[model samples]
Target: MEMQVWASLFGVILGGLLSYLAQFTTVRLAARNEEKRQAAQRAEARRSERLELLREFIAITQAGIRIAEERDQAPDWDAAGTPEWFAAARNIIDRLWVAERMIEVLFSPQMYQLARAYASAVDHVLWRLPEQIAAEGSMWDHLRGPQHEFLAGARTDVGSLP
Candidate 1:
């Protein structure tokens, strides 16, 4: 073959290889970026779910105290009629039940675990409050006591959302 023809063939082959490699690298990088973006979106969704659970848990605990106070022996203004705490508890539970369904929509096992922990803490507070009331003991103090470290459980793995 002529030298010029050989040179032309070599140049064309090299250009083709370079083009293919460039496209391959670009596609790979784009795929990687897409994956990272998806992961970040999933993480944000989970954090949102976790924060919702925390809000409900806190609301329930705070409101349960108020509901009980409505039936208190003393009528401190803080103990006035219409137990806000009781209402708060019921409201939080109602909101949380919906949040639980939302967690399924977002579908992250880790987030679900955090949410479940919050639910458990709130449930414990709700369940134990009546007993503490019957015993004429402070429920807040009861929470601080060795009630299987309920407070600690409440503190575990809570994710905050901005």
Candidate 2:
């Protein structure tokens, strides 16, 4: 009778140990899974931010291209600087300023450089349109090569990232 009582007590103790170990393992696994979930969420947020920034960059760059192409229409930039020209330039400059600020915060150095190249191409058009057109008869024709190059480089940069 005493042996039977001892066996039952041992069995109870073993069952309790087993229960404790199972709970401990389950808690650790749950914590690990939570950490993974949080990390994945952070990564996704950063990716969305990068995509949004790139989209804004593309928008501003395309607007600048359109402006450059439009300037190609006027006989001279002196003649082109009408109210409409100033208004369009103002709008584009404002948006470009915002994009540049975002780039400074979010982009890698190479990405920023690509953006700067595109912006500089636009500035070149804005500053030298009259002279370029006066000399070459079609300003955009000359600028198009560099503009395309900058834009393509930027696109490649964006595509290469995961």
Candidate 3:
């Protein structure tokens, strides 16, 4: 009789400990999963923002190229750096800067650095734009390289452009 009682008590204690351990483990796993999910969401948001920024840069670049192509020729020879194109390029650079900050905020440090580099390259090309276009040469030919680079980098997101 005494042996039976001790066995029952031991069983109860073992069951309680097992249950507690299982619950604790499950909670830890749940927390870990939530953290992963949150990080993935943040990373995805950063990628999307980067894609959008690239698209904007491409559009602005293309627009400037278009203006130069359309309005510049032998007799017309509009200064490639018209106020309108400058305003457009400036807006693009401003937006690119803002997007870079957002990427820094949302992406992992490595990804943020890579994206920053890409944005900077695109910005540099766009910024040098007016001078490159106006300096005794038509810009259309010069624009092709940067235009291709930006468009290629942004291809996944560029499909949505109308």
TM-score of each: 0.60, 0.78, 0.60
Which 10-residue window of candidate 2 scores lowest in summed lDDT? 124-133
The best candidate in terms of lDDT: 2
TM match of model 3 to true structure: 0.60
lDDT tens string, model 3, 1-162?
A: 999999999999999999999999999999999999999898777667766655554454455444435445425434655787778667766766676676567434654565465556555445543456567354445545545554454463335432
**Cα misplacement distance, residue 147 of candidate 2 (Å):** 4.6
Give the Cα lDDT of each candidate: 0.58, 0.75, 0.60
Instruction: Give per-residue lDDT, candidate 3, residue 147.
Output: 50
Clashes of each: 1, 0, 0
Backbone clashes in model 1, listed as residue pairs: 63-85
lDDT of 2 by residue, 15-53 (tens): 999999999999999999999999989877987888888
Ranked by TM-score, the better of candidates 1 and 2 is: 2
- Give lDDT for model 2: 0.75
Error of 2 at 65 (Å): 1.4
Q: How many backbone clashes does candidate 2 have?
A: 0
Q: What C-alpha RMSD separates each model from the true structure?
A: 5.5, 2.8, 6.3
- Pairs clashing within candidate 2: none
